[model samples]
Target chain A: MSMTLEELTDRTGLTVLDHLEQQVRIPVVDGLQAQGDLIVIPLAVLDDVDVPARARWRPVPPSGVELLRGAAGGNPHTLVAEPGAAEWTTEVHDRQRLAVGVLRATRPAYLIHSEHGGSGIAPGTYLVRRQRERSTQRGGQADFLVAD
Target chain B: MRPTSTAGTGRRRSATSGCGPPCTPNPPTGNAERAITGLYALLGRRRPRFHWAASPRQAVDLLDEPPLRLGGPVDPAAPWHVAHQLADAAHRLAGRLDERAGPVGTFWWTTERIVRTRPPADALAAGVSLAELLVVGVRNSLGRSVHDGLRTPLRAALTEAVGEPPGLRWHGQHDAPWVAYHDVRRRLRPGLFHPDDDRQVDLWADIARSCGWWWPREDVCVVTERTGVAHTEALPGALHGEVRTHNRHGPAVGYADGWGGHSWHGTAVPAWVIEEPTVERIGAERNVEVRRCAIERLGWDAYLDQARLTLVAEAADPGNPGCRLQLYDLPQHVWGTPARVLLAVNGSVERDGHRRRYGLSVPADLDDPVAAAGWSYGLSGEQYARLLRRT
Candidate 1:
């Protein structure tokens, strides 16, 4: 029943990046959204894991992975719910806030904003954190820090 | 590995190691040919009774005897096996020794390294004198008992597989309780074996050698105190560091931390804590004092807290501007080697006064913080074990 990342993507009808996302269980935050390539998974979902123990932050790219946004000025970047995926209920305080996560795989998940051209954000489904509220500057992209 | 007779027993038994025909010197057609043939024959058989000779000439003479066939030398690392056999024999001898001859703790400590680690090959090649080490080992075991003619040939054959006796020195009763010394500055400081105190002096050597001198160097400590004594009536101030409690059997149970008013059984006594910078020469007296003060003041959990924090601080990426990275929690217990961590990066803060548009990326294969901290503290695996023993 074991398959490589490519095979899992082919079998499950998920993108290569989505296949990586399927490797780790991510938490669901009510009212939380994915801005740019950013996604929020509650820390509680990691109850069975010890991510904080080693204190590592992994980054993945924000390109190509499918995500559904909230309609009509709601959370601009929210993930479309996956069928049969296990979900946990948790609260998110601010529209834009700091959050943490671990990457499920390394692949191009989203396009990098023009401003971050000098900084290397590899293509992958990253464990990400919402570092802060997205800047409201003109043409500024809602950016999330992703680390693997 | 049978119970062998004393070395003094007038009996000889040899393991059938299939050595070829007895060495008969060929008649000399020429001095050089005869010498070469003799050397080849000597080199061909594996003879076992060789002892550590005091002089080169004596070693050569010993090798010249028929029973002393210098068959191909055993593996260099075989000295450990040799020392194991020797220790087994010494253990038997310990039962015959007088109580005054001192407990077997001193003997076991003395032989710990020799029996546990491989001796250098050159030293093994030079040959070990089991006969000599046996006399010394047996003498120490006897304590005040006269050497009851135990150096039997059967005893020597016990070391047939192992070539040489590892270098060990026994100080015996003259040094009293601390009767053995190993690895130069180290002392086999023996106190009475107390079941309640849980101090197994024989095993102490393993911990000591395992960690070197990193653990606390106290002769005894109050590992646990009996409940219900008035706080004021607890371990008296006068009996602090050197206090030793003996059970009904008259064996010392544990030592007391006079300052903290707690007693520790042997098992509870922690290893030396390296608090000071100067580790080169930790005086024995100062070592115990420092250990007592530390345990009484900081405690084990506090030390772990500090150690973890130190790891986090040291792992920070100083080069990244406002590059706030920290370890959030410990890795799973099963995780080993270079660890992957849940890193928290503060993207809010500006480094070098730059407001960046994009968030930071996490690096791969981060440096191991705990290892770095241990090195910074100059703690070895054994010293680190002290901290783990508590947690």
Candidate 2:
């Protein structure tokens, strides 16, 4: 009872299996993305089947492509997320997200307090404060002054 | 790419590359060409590695490589990448050195340029100091570190990619803790800044080349040539003319004021604050003493209070650099050019007067932050970062 991807697409909205009841496998496209937990049921036996809109097939980010390279290329071993990676989740958005973030080295900065040494004890937390001050032209920021 | 052993028989790995062209060399002919070709043949030429495959797959192509957004998962400019990069650098640094040298606080900063906004003193009541800076350096309310996923290999690769001359690096156990420094002053010449120039380089860029002096210079201050000499009218005072940018921008060099004075060198910064007393650098020991007395006599609380009313206070006791140095710009930071400065004064009372504006305003870039170039003329973290960019 094998079904064709075209026939399956007609029956269901899913991207159906291209092949059925065979050992052959199809390669994943270069930039195509996998949503959530990916289970490839090769339609060769079933893997190549067409699943409908059950999952979205969108182009992944260049970085994401690298991150999920194996899954995209049908490498079973590499497809598994890194040990502590979060389960894959699909996100739909209206506007593009230009999210920028930075991470600091949190593990307490090493200080020389008894544990390390003493004689050379010199520096401590060198706290640097950065500010954005706009200097005006001509009189230069006459606006910031309190009226005389 | 695989973990290949160097002792291989002429076999090198290769990957599909879409790069427009390959690095070319002089096309040798005749004897020379034959000799080189024969040598390559004898050595067994193998395809070189091309890691950053536009396609996605591995976290990185191979060893000593890093992964960042190129195509999909995240915006190339995501701060997450910055955070991660910092964290990665710190992690690497920690791994390299003895962790027992107390906790190391890696100071990461950046800078940018933009049309200055003459925001009144009241507009920005908040100015940063050491204690407050401590908080900003930490992770936000989110337990995640602020620099959690930022990837800035550029900063790390600075030493490796030397253009003119190799940048000067000062490394040693500062107080037994490993402190490696590479500043701008080492590579650049002084007297590079021309206050008259409009398109000037930011501060930190210059410092990256010299001043391995590590951030806070012992004695550093910028005074605009436009107003260094005392008033042209000798007035009743001595012939010492009065000079003052009045905290304005044009030809005005915001001096970095610190005994252990801090140098602002970065692409961008958050904020910078310089108390009035800080600029008065007479002698090394005297300077430290005066500040100690100033903070003590003025009361630390009063200093904090003036945190907002900067202009008024700076006016009350305008920065006096004795005789103004025609060298107004910060040579260590600005890379021989003046800077787009922002002024945020503590204290209060508002009334727009003469000065126009300097430094970048948030209006240009939606995501860009609004910040001062240091409370005075120094570059903020963001400003410093901007200077680090290649010309």
Candidate 3:
């Protein structure tokens, strides 16, 4: 079922609040306007992100899923598309440890690859929560509400 | 046509013709122009950046300047032997250079190895970047190498570079020190994984190197193995090693492998519990089982709802389940701005299943009697801040 961006925000803490608040004061050309149903937010960026308090909200760590950095540097986090092959696929040996996940209905549709190695779950969207203020956002953030 | 004058080493350039070209032709005689043209044709394709000498005399003069030599001793200066010696040195040093050194470093190293001594005054003016010299070496070394077969060109190139005559040897051990780290990279990485694409191999190699784990040849799959889970299907020939078991021959009470699977309602296992040696698992189980009896009574959600922090224990290991009492705190009400605090008590008792799926809310400060029951599981202040910040 398709959910609005607001409902998506309620279920999964992913939001474009930081982007909205930060860009609100910046003066730009008329052509430079934000648009799109898919709002991408990086939990963290190398650049400064100045957002507002009204838009701030705590992120609940996704239940039954833990974000882990690949053995490679950058502490990159990803969801494997095939949770069953996790041991051989994403683990040290397989060399197929790609970051896998997509934002569905503004919630993280992660490929849960855990030590258990396999899951009965099919390759479909599953709601996931971000770790508290992981400081990155990606996916659709359309409603640009400035409540301040 | 033997080298015009070998200095009597009898090591004719012909000896390495089978290895690849730029096999220095018969040293220039009266037909210096003919010899110079042939030399340029043979080597220029690969090292186009280097200025070709207009005549044999020029080629010989280029060598008059001592060239850097990397792997062996200095060659004697002999004008008659100049062209041949340079060719020989280039061929020998080609594959020997390390890919890790990158283009510039490899160039510098190659020149030092080939020149055998200081370069001529006009070395830079001669018009060749260090990159050209390296290209010559790499190309020559790789030229004769077959691209595919049981003995593929990749293998041949590796063998030449490693300087190990019969070629690569595989022991299947991740940490085979004798093997050049690059040659047996596939085995060094844990798993029965083979990259189907070159990019995959590169990506894996990058990750492996970044982890500072290229040596000691550890595999992720190997370390992930636990009791009862047979890896023969997953790892094939690699499961010769055994894990620490509780009762030398006791039944393998392998972990659930799924998170929160150790509890009565658990479908997975805990990582911390899995880390404890097999022997420790037995003792830990008895303690966990007894606590499970209490938790089953308190009711899971009811116990969790009342407290701000929840301690979760699973059935994997009773003693070191790594389960802790997670205490929740809100400092904003007592101080100013709202702040969340998560205190994980390390030394909590396992008598009751409270450590597993139970929460406790204490007063604003740490004066509660439960605070003294265990040490704080080492979450530093910075970590706590990261954990608490909402945005």
Candidate 4:
């Protein structure tokens, strides 16, 4: 299931900058991994999140799904997988309210980004959460989602 | 079953690529005059006197009366009101075209939102048709760029420079949105609209491509030339060829009469931001967003050093080996809020192979840097301490 950055970009038609190393095989990690403002955590690692019974799941197409876009809006963190190997849903309830969606993959899935490069996920179920920082505007104590 | 063939997709014929209106400094006045004459003919009136101005600011001085007479008794003997006639004709034409374009259901609404916000490639990947892409391109995206991005700020700057405009005016180049919308629809579907409506649409399109702003009066029409210089950059994450005004050193948009505005990214700011971003000026600035933009212009480290914010706590970042997260108390009077700043280093290295430092605002209550860092990720201090890797 391991693939190099070059092969992954070619398969998905998503691109990374020429500066990133293209030949090295991306590691398929089963544990936690962070890419910029997004973090991927194994479902078993946390008990605060739950996927509802009636949650609708969408198959991750060959073109991939854009999980998050960078602050200035150019770079996108895209999740891609082989046909029929993965599915995604935003129906999960998180206690922290940071979870963007949940990813369930029967085969290896890779998250590709133009600046941060690629992060491979081993076959498993995981929760993808966006990072947030405290907001200082207007004196409200609510946290704002981190964009980058 | 999914349709595998691209027969009716209109991918080849649709002009989705480079669909935005041209931002030309010198527009063709000849075509514009002809279009205005055609529009006058449609209203069954003789052509009005055409007065050309080098810029909108100059055109404002040429008006004898307010463009819109808000509330007044209509003279029964008057031949016609040019503005009202033009508006009514355009509205009826749009109504007929909308009927032919089909009903905009929930699916169309959702797709339109995606087309407006995300990249065109993303919309295409989501199964949006090429024709729909063109619709959003010429309408939503072009409107965002020409009207919202360029015209709005320029109008504001003009208002600030001169008092409120004395007359009502129409944005000639900025009207590309609606004009191009009708033009694209008729061009794509061909027989979808009436031939008469098609001719009217063409005249409006010609005016859009040939001028800047204009004032239409009963006996006279005043058309202004385009800006002498306009600087813009790609709107981050735009689905079409959308752009916003931006210039680091000077005015983003400037006219022949020396009227212009300065912008950072897409946010319109005072000329001082681009000219002289001094710490003293930034401190006195009341707007939080403006203050932030000024601080960014002067690097975070430099601002923190010059402002001399009191340090509260510092801790070694959990995952980032050598970097330390530092917290500083923000002055209540200056910030107008109870908050602290957490300075941290970027996890990923830039193209230069050096990690960058950034600051994030945090609630003033937290004194522990690790706890503040944990708060950012929705994890407890102990939970975040076990972090393994950062990209």
Candidate 5:
């Protein structure tokens, strides 16, 4: 009953990962700092990340997960969070020929979206690993698979 | 209305205090000024750094990492519009790349098509339908007028910048053109897959572009430079890792050596099996500080180094486990320091199960084999990117 989130995800089933897909919410600062931003935090000063509140997705080939980098030369931007009708939420689509994992990061103080897809698992979402507090060298609790 | 100063002008200043100095209203602050003032008040102290950092485009691009066009703060909604917006943005951006490239049509849109779905009772895997895979690839390369969507923007931008339509390279394949080399990207990537009948993947048969050539692949092998388990604890020695698989699919473990090439124990899923954590493990042991300092900087080059004096030094102690390390002198990885690494994972995932995991010890940098066997590892930028995480 008390297995760390990492343990839960380590035993990740398609069901569980899929379930978290619907849980994607607006990314909290920590999620961005520690994860989303963490991945590409330094690609540059990150001049801009003008994602819209809503987005449409398609799978890219030869690789998984790319920010709609842009058509040949036009500036590329990704649509991200949206203020939902009832609450805040986000979504991801499998544009690829096959399904793959999507990573998400969130905090406990905030609310993430609830699962609504037909499948019990929200396939694309973040799974917590080792959550650390920014202010101190302490451990915090984490939930698995927060979708981006 | 005047303040009810009836008896309230307790100080009884003078005639100068008449009507509170004519109700002199200070000029109203503009919306931009008021907004700024309110922000400062809410924040309490003036954050000098934030002021400078918040200049025009600074923050906008900060959030501009992936999932294009709708580049705002990331969200959790599964909206149809979000996908459309990003695709549109991608089309726009692709156009710009061509504009910047100049007259040669140096740019092109590549796509792939594969069978991703299988009937439940068909006895095949969940995503093995090649036909489905092909459909999805076309959808990506041509769907939503993907090519048109992207090409128009590319052309306008190109014509503006240089003056020509970009040379095009469609990565996907449909019923047309039947046979020619495809884009190098079509070479086995694992992440992009879908069911044969998924609605999103169906447009390929109706609208698709054909290509004349496939990307070239190499059957190169990266032999490990060091040997045995202790090589792991030796810090620097551990970084010298490598492995050789069929230039494209999975790992090369459990293979029988043969000039004709060998077979491997694998997931057989037919995709790129990027073991990013394993790449980090090498970084953890060899350059823990760097890994901690900034992860992005730890490219493959960092792992490739001369067999450090230690391994050569280990030769003196044939009895030392470190000395009996595996040999990775592929003529391909003999660049700069002449360091060597081989990707070696347990040949079998389960002692009894046939599935295997390969631990490829790639140089943190690109070190080409120095031999004349025309040996090139042919590692793609994407593969190198696979090993890295945002630092």
Candidate 6:
């Protein structure tokens, strides 16, 4: 069943800004979804990424796993799921060096942010990647990760 | 709460509460003077003549001779500098304390690693005790906040405006982290350190709680009052009340002598960046981070129009219906680099019911807006084109 922003926050004890729509049901997407600077793509969509055989996985806790915090350090994009419903691993090899982690869910898991609200993930394995921009300070071809 | 968690909670509470230097302008109390005298007594020296200053800026000016002369040959006959003697004593004391604290084990290392990285809640949930959290909080978190966060930046600014300090200085308030760390250890693990060492730690802790900065010499000591005005904001993800200097309208940290610095989200920047950011000023600024901060202060839309950058290309953003991706050339003089700016709209609506637009710097060679956008996500232009949804 899909959950609203209020329901998700209440379940996880996480909070969002009061301005966000609280009652609307958050969509559970089986495909790709973007939240701020983070993008979640179904594992089947990418050919250059791989999850190794010896990868360690930790079950997503009730309080959720904080995936990324904003540049200034306040807002965080947290991944939440029913206990035992999802497992996450950081041992993924991505050609682009942008993969934050890989998430495998047996049931619907949600990515929640104070500003972006919640984006529900359908039961599936997915690769989460952070965005980057060209770095002008270093004078060469270096990329700076976007924290927001 | 778990019954066993109370001890941890108490330790965590005390550590956070005792974490930072007092920012208010409180003159050093008689207790501070007693502590300094006690420290001198430990070194077999009499109490030095105390010279007080309103601020660190004024304190530097009061020095008749450089407290520390760099790159000089050691003279065996010359009396040891009081500062050096104190440093040596502190090192030896710490060594003895370490012996009592026991060897660093895997558990300690694991907890330290987790404390340094993950959120405090996560570390606690992972079975890290509150006492351990207190240790890391005082050593790492408080150190980062008081020493690295505030003192270092303020020191750099002071050095630029004045020069290298006249002598080796002691951060009176900024020394809270180290002192607090030892104090917490002694309190939590009673009798972990010798009584004499505990007394020494108390002296240092008193000074940290009492003043701003200090300089110690054989016959004289120079002490500065606390900052008259200091502004700070909670570090975004800090688990132990860590804070950094941040003020949009005025100096993030200022003293009574009108000496202070401006910071934008912890980054020390020139006053103009905060006060009068203009396109011309931003173009002339060589530092990339400073320039970016100025541009952000000026807003992207206003900067684009005022800078009048040449439009390179434009395309509709996939999945973000009605939003367009526009590219503009950043002049060599403007950015000091061969790069293009891709202006994209946020996928989510903001609280004000408006979508925010931001610019991403891309390699100059990419002329196609779609390819540039794809490059940001490490995907091919064709691959990103199949995107289905944006929040």
Top of the candidates by TM-score: 6
**lDDT by residue for model 2 (B1-391), tens:** 0101101211111221223222111221122223222222322432222112111111011112232334466443542333333234434543433232223234333200000121122212333222222212221111111011110111222222332211111111110111111111112333322432101122222221121111110121110000011101111111111111111111111111100111111111111222333222211223232333333223333433443222211211121112111101221121112322122222111133222111221111122122222122122323322221000
> Which regions of candidate 5 are displaced past 4 Å?
A1-3, A10-45, A53-148, B1-258, B261-303, B307-391
lDDT of 6 by residue, B188-240 (tens): 88988888888888888888766668877777777776565656766655667
* Model 3, span B1-391: residue lDDT tens: 0110111222222332342212233332112223223333443422112222222222223323343334455444432233344345334433343433245544555454443222322333455454443333222222211111111222222233333322111111111121123333334344323333223333323322211111111010001111111111111111111111111111112212211112111111222232332322322443443232222234333433433332322122111234333444433322122222323322222334233232222223443222311112111222222221011
Worst 10 residues of 5 chain B by lDDT: B224-233
Q: What tens-digit string does per-residue lDDT give for candidate 4 at B294-338?
A: 766666676787899999999998767888989988787656677
DockQ of 4: 0.35
Residue A140 local lDDT, model 6: 35
Cα deviation at B191, candidate 1, in Å, is 32
TM-score of each: 0.17, 0.14, 0.18, 0.66, 0.19, 0.70
Ranking by lDDT: 6, 4, 1, 3, 5, 2
Give the alpha carbon lDDT tens digit for every residue of A10-82 in model 1: 4334342221223432222221122333433323332232343445432322222222222111222222212
**How much does each candidate deviate at the interface, measured as C-alpha RMSD after superposition?**
24.3, 25.2, 21.5, 3.1, 20.5, 2.7
lDDT of 5 by residue, B1-391 (tens): 0001111111212211233211221222122123223223332423111111111122122222233334566443432233333344435534543343234222112211112122222312433333333333332223212222212222232233333321211222212221111121133432222332121222222112211101111111011000001000011111111111221222222111110111111111111122232343433333332222121112222333322312211111111112112224323212222333332222112334332222123332333321110011122232212312111
Estimate candidate 4's alpha-carbon lDDT, on a 0 to 1 scale: 0.75
Give per-candidate clash totals. 60, 171, 39, 1, 160, 1
Name the candidate, 1 or 6, with the larger DockQ value: 6
Question: What is every candidate's C-alpha DockQ against the true complex, given to 2 decimals?
Answer: 0.01, 0.02, 0.04, 0.35, 0.01, 0.41
Q: What is the Cα-based lDDT of residue B251 in candidate 3?
A: 17
Q: How accurate locally, in lDDT, is each candidate?
A: 0.25, 0.20, 0.24, 0.75, 0.22, 0.77
Docking class of 1: incorrect
Sort every candidate by TM-score, greatest first. Answer: 6, 4, 5, 3, 1, 2
